[model samples]
Structures are given as C-alpha cells and as structure tokens.
Target: MAGETDPLATEQPPLSAGDLPAELPGELIAPEVAALEVPPELVAQSLGEYVRAWGARIRGGDPGVLPVILGLAIIAVLFQIVSPGNVFLSAGNLVNLFQQSAVFMVLGMAEIFVLLLGEIDLSTGYVAGLAGVIGVQLVQPVTTNFPWWVAIMAALLACAVIGAAQGTLVARLRLPSFVVTLGGNLIFNGVMLWALLFGPFSGYPTLGDQTNPHVLYQLMWGTIDPLIGWIILTALVVVVGGSFWLRDSRRRRSGLVAPPVSLTALKIVLIAVVGAAVVAICNINRAHFGTIEGVPWVILIVIGLLGLWTVLLQRTRFGRYIYAIGGNPEASRRAGINLVRVRTLAFVLCSMTAGLAGLLYVANQGGASNNFPGGQYVLYAVAAAVIGGTSLFGGRGRVLHGVLGGLVIGGINNGLYLLGLDVKVQFVVTGFVLLAAVTIDALSRRGASVGSVAHI
Candidate 1:
C-alpha cells in the first residue's frame, strides 16, 4: 500500500500545455539527453567527412569512357582544323594515313623492346636500310642469286647479329646504351653506303630491268574494298568486345574495380564508329583516272607488328622483366631476372624490326641508291617513337603510341604539303612536336608522382 500510494497522488495535478516542455510528454529522458549531448564540433566534422568522401568518389579512376572518347574527338577536331574542307577525313586519305603510319608502327613496336628495358638503340634505321640493301643484293644476279625469302632471312640474321653485338657491348661490358648505340648508328650507316655504291639493288623481282614504271608504281599503290573493310571491322569488333568483356569479368572476380558497364559499351561504340569510318573513307576512290582498294600491305604489316608487340609486352615474362628492368634495374637483378639476355634480345628484335622496315622502304621506293641516308631516317624513327608516347627515358610507352605519333608527324607533313609549305618548315615543325611530346611526358610523370588528375 505504501509503494502504490504515490501513483494516484502524482496524477492529482493536471499540467497545462504551456507548462509542458516542447518534447513529447512522458518520453524517456535518456534519449533526450543523448540527443542534446551531440557536440556542434561533431556536426561540423561530419559535414567535412561527407564532402571529402564525395570528392574522392568523383576523382577516382572510374571516369567512365569519357577520357578516351574525348581524346579521340579532340584528335578529330585538330585534324579538321589543320586541313580545311575536311580533306584529311577523306577515305583515300585515311588509307594513306594508315600506309604512312605503318613504318612508324613497326619501328615503334621494335623500339618498345629496348624502351621497356630503359635502353636506347640508335642504329635501327641504318640497320634496316642495310638489311634491305643486302637482301636485295643477295637476290640480284650480280650478288648471290638467292631466293627472295632467303634474302629476307639473310637480312634479318645480319640485323640480329649486329643487334646482338651491340647488346653485348652494352650489357656484358657495362657500357652506356646511348654510347654503344650511337656508335652502332655510324657503323651501320657506313655499311649501308658501302653496299649501295657498287650496283642498283632492285627490290622488285618481277618488274625486270626497269628503274620505275608508271603502271607498276600504280600497282604499288593501295586500295580499300568496302566489303572487306566491313568484314575486318566486324572481326575487330568481336575481338575487341570479347577482350573487354573478359578483362572486366576477371577484374570484378578478382575484387578489383572494373570499368562501369556504360563505359565499356561506350568504348565499343566509339571503336566501331571509327573503324567503320576508316573503311568507308578508304573505299572512296581518290584517283580520278584509276581506282585504289583496301589498306596497303604496309598497313597490314604495321598492324600485325603492333598486335604482336602488344602481346609481347603485355603477356610475356620476358616483357615483364624488360619493364621491371626499365622501372628499376637493381630490383630486377635482385629478383633473379636476366638483364643481359633481356637486353640482348631487345636489341636483336629492335634491329630485326628495323630491317623489316628497311625492306618496306625499298619496296616502296623501287630501288636502293648510294645517296640514301639511313642516319636521317633513324632520327625520324626515334622522333616518331618519342612523339607517339614512348618515353625517351623508357618504362612508359606502347606500340600504338608510336603509330599515333607517326601519324601525327605524317599528318603534319601531309598537311604542310597540301598548304605548299617548305620542307625545312616541315622539319622544324616536326622537331617542335617531338620536343613538346617529350616535355609533356616528363611533366605528366612528375604530376603523376604528385597525385594530380591533370598529369596525363
């Protein structure tokens, strides 16, 4: 009775609404106390936390396919601006672009091996020229009378030997690559001059005694078939799409942040569009008197090389080691990687690729001449590689970069020619572009180190 007495006594006085607190009546005090205890400082801190989290999410590497697509768009705009009336966008011109960029692509792939190892090979162009000269000479009656295939093999082997020797000097002797390669450059050029002095090395076996024929020259020109182009485009789409899908799935399964589905789809669409455009442009007949079809064999060769080099760099253990060495040689050596073998192979491959390029050049030109200067061409090749995105300092480039860079240079040349600019001006502009590319690469790398989004 005593314990229950307060229940009625407490309820005797009814409180007015004005006398009650704003909070719900008869609510537990603990909850109110907890709510009131939250600090003003904490509220401010929570807002700051939320803002920082949001900033991070937006700036993270998941910007969809915007960057790549945007880059391509910009390239298109630039080309259009440089060449009025969109002449650069013509189908025949597009095929020409591929042909023009092909040599650069091959050289770029070759350069990738040495680049990955953080070494330089200056003799690529000379070696290539020499290989071509020697190859042609071997097949000529005045020389060895060898089969065409045999001549090609001989040229490649010679290049390989030269490359290996240079590599040995750099790796085994512990010489600086720049010095070794620079010397090789001089030596190879001298050899090329010596080969060219005695007789004409005609590249074409079937042409017979003619220096240059208009009909044969026309045959050398490339053409594009719309149907074939479309077929190739379809194949490319399937391959590229499959690769992306597989890659994304693997990344997701491995707990990595994969590209958004939207981004992937967008990339596919853009690639398809570009591919189709290229095919369509190439299908157009540029010559009013005659017709040209599909991309030149040269373009095919370059694309093939690009694909091969990409695989080598991205998939092979040797490629991995090359990059590791470039990134940090000491770490690679400590990890039991064979620096000598890798470096040697790199030089050999570089030279061999150069040789192939030389063959293409001779084929394009119809004959080899004593006045041919391999030194100048070598410089162009180096410039092309650097311009395309292969870092002169190494460890940060791709084969495709070389192709693009080559095209950029080629574009400048073509554009200037269309505008009736002088050769000297072309050279100056190309040099400037090369310098700019290197500067950009250095700056981008620095920015990357500093954690900036604008580094690229």
Candidate 2:
C-alpha cells in the first residue's frame, strides 16, 4: 500500500476545520473564500449604479439666465424676417419706435404693480382718459386757469383716490377684481364724458397759441443738439458702470457667487453699444418737410418711470410684500405682511401711472376727442404685459420686459403700416402674436413643472 500511494492522495492537503481539500474539486471552493474578494462583474455593476444616481441629480430643474437671452434673440430674428427691407432696421424707424412705445411702456409699469398682487385693473384706460380731460379743463382759460403743475397734481390725486376706493372694496369686502374694475371702468368713462361735455376743456396747446407760446409742448417735442445726446450717453455709461462695479464688490464681500468677470464686462459693453446706437439714430434728421431731430422728451419720461418702478419693485420692502402676497397670501399673512395696505398702495400707484400715460398720450397726439377709444388701448396695455412674459398668475415679471414687449408690438404696427397693410390686417396679426405669446407662457410653465429645459 505504501509503495502504491494514490496520485490523488499525493496532491491533496490535510483537511482542517472550515477548510476544503484541494482534491475536492475547483468548483467546491468554500463560501468564506469566495466572499473575501469581490468579482470584477460586481465592481462594474456598482459603478453603473453610481453613474445613474449622478445623472438623476444633474437632471433636476434649476433656474438659469439662458431663457431670457434666448427670448430676446428670437424676437430680433422674427422682426428681421417679417420686415427685411431695412425699414425696421433704420435709425429713424428705431427712434420712432421708442417714441411710439412710450405710452405702452408707462402703462406696462403701471400694470406691474397690480400684477405683483395678482390683480388686474380694467379701468386703467378710461381712468386715464378722464384724467386727461380734467387736466385739459384745468389748464383752459375758460376754467380756473390753474398752473399746469396743479392740473397734473389734481389729475393724479383723482386717479389715486379712485384706485384706493376700488382697492378697499376688493381687499376689505373681498369683492372680485373683475367685477369691481369693470364697474369702475363704466364710472370713469361717464366722468370723462361729463368733463368733455360740461367742463371748459380746450384742445392741446399749440406752438403759437399764447403770446408766450406753449413752453410745455416745446419741452416735450423739442429736439436736443447732437452734442447733448453724446453727453447724456457718456453720463449714462459712467453711472451704469459704477453701479455694476459696486454690486460686484458687495457680492464678493458677502461670499456670494457673482457673475464671472467676462460676463459682467459683456453686459456693460452691450449696454454701451445700445446707448450709443440709440443716440446716433436719434441724432439723425428724420424731418422731410421740416426740421426734426433727437428724441422726444416723452421718451425720457417713459424711461424714467420704468427705472423708478423697477427700483420700487426690486429694492423696497413694500415691493417684497406685494410679491409675497401674490405668491402665497396665507403664508405672507402668517409672516405679518399687511395685505390690505400693500394692495391699496399698489392700486393707487397703478392708477396714478395710468394717468401719467394718458397725459403723455394726449400731449403726443396734440388733442383728445370723444372717439379716442381708450378702452381699446387699455386692452393693448394688458396684452403687451402678457406678451412680454409677465405671468398672468402673477409674482413674476420685469419692467424691462414690458419695454421690450411694447417695442415688439409697436414694431409690428409700424412695419405693417410701412408695408401698406390694412388696419384690419394689423389687428389680426397682433391678435395672433398675442395668442402665441400666451401659449408659449403656458407651455413654459408646464415644462418647468416636469423638470424640462424648455421652460422659458
């Protein structure tokens, strides 16, 4: 037996507790040995799981700056395509566009206040018309012959009171805004008619109306020298540059993420280019039979209002409360935000601004007639806001959005006129554009809820 030892016995080791003999077979490895090291396949599986986890995180929705920029680009392209004869691109046309959009721009800012509170003011147009008639009556010699400043103040005060009254009914009595504003609209229209029929309201002041001439008219429509345009442009650049630098410094000091230096510089450059282009365009002579140059004072007035309203909404606590109320009224109340006061103030401001726009409109037109169709213009103001990205649901919009949106609408109007299109065609086209804008807004909101990049 010793001389004939088995070959298998010679290769096998002595079995120990918890150990397997080598002759047991390759497939008979102990479970403990198998568990000591992971297989390459297992490692590959774990890596796949990790990748999927990270992918999910990356797909989450995040607010970004791309949407706003893309919107502006698409607008520019559409206008270019629709009116390719350089008429839309001409310097004179651009200046005219700004002038034409001034009223809507002001109205848009007015709407912002109500929009922030998730409310609407259907009476704005009629209110403006009534205020204009009152303003003209006050300035008329047959009336009290009040100073222009006094008349303006009276008109603004009247509008504010009406607005406050409406707000009280809505906020205190819990009345529906649609019904309240609709009633107010009718009342204001009656007041306008009364003022025109009974009050001593003269037409707008003409160049040679009075012995001293109409200084106010001159101020509104007069042209500035080219030198003045350049000076104003330079001042604007300095102020805007200083503001950006200060903002960046504060952000850095607070350990907040500031925009990249390149991005900041790009913004400044873009602003400067736009300002320069505007100045150059306005400096051109557009007068065919007479001398007309530079921008209208109404243009400055509109821009000033825009800046003021933007600051109010973005920088003030009141503005914050308004937005809060719109977003979540109950939550805002729990946080001690006064819904009544803020809502009232917003309505008052909106009405006063509407008055301002109305005055500007009459001044630009040089007269106001009963057939001015204030109601139609009011609808246009609302449409402009919606088209410019102001959410109907509220708590989201910008003053600049209104300006750009107004310009887009004004451009369409001007372009259609230049192309010799009928007024009916213009109206139809505008209606379609408004519809498209609203559809896009709805789709964007839906996309945002679903974690899609198409939200814009």
Candidate topping TM-score: 2
Tell me the lDDT of candidate 1.
Answer: 0.67
Candidate 2 structure quality by residue, lDDT tens digits, 290-322: 777876676667767887888888777877777
Query: How would you encode candidate 1's per-residue C-alpha lDDT over 371-439 as one tens digit per residue?
Result: 555776777787777777677776767777767667776777766765678989889988887787777
Instruction: Give the lowest summed-lDDT range of ten residues in model 1.
Output: 36-45
In the order shown, the candidates' Cα RMSDs to the true structure are: 19.1, 20.0
Poorest lDDT segment (10 consecutive residues) of candidate 2: 35-44
**TM-score for each model:** 0.75, 0.79
Q: Per-residue lDDT for 441 in model 1?
A: 67
Model 2 steric clash total: 0
The deviation in Å at residue 250 for candidate 1 is 4.8
Query: Candidate 2: which stretches are off by over 4 Å?
Result: 1-86, 198-208, 211-220, 452-456
Local accuracy by lDDT, each model:
0.67, 0.69
TM-score of 2: 0.79
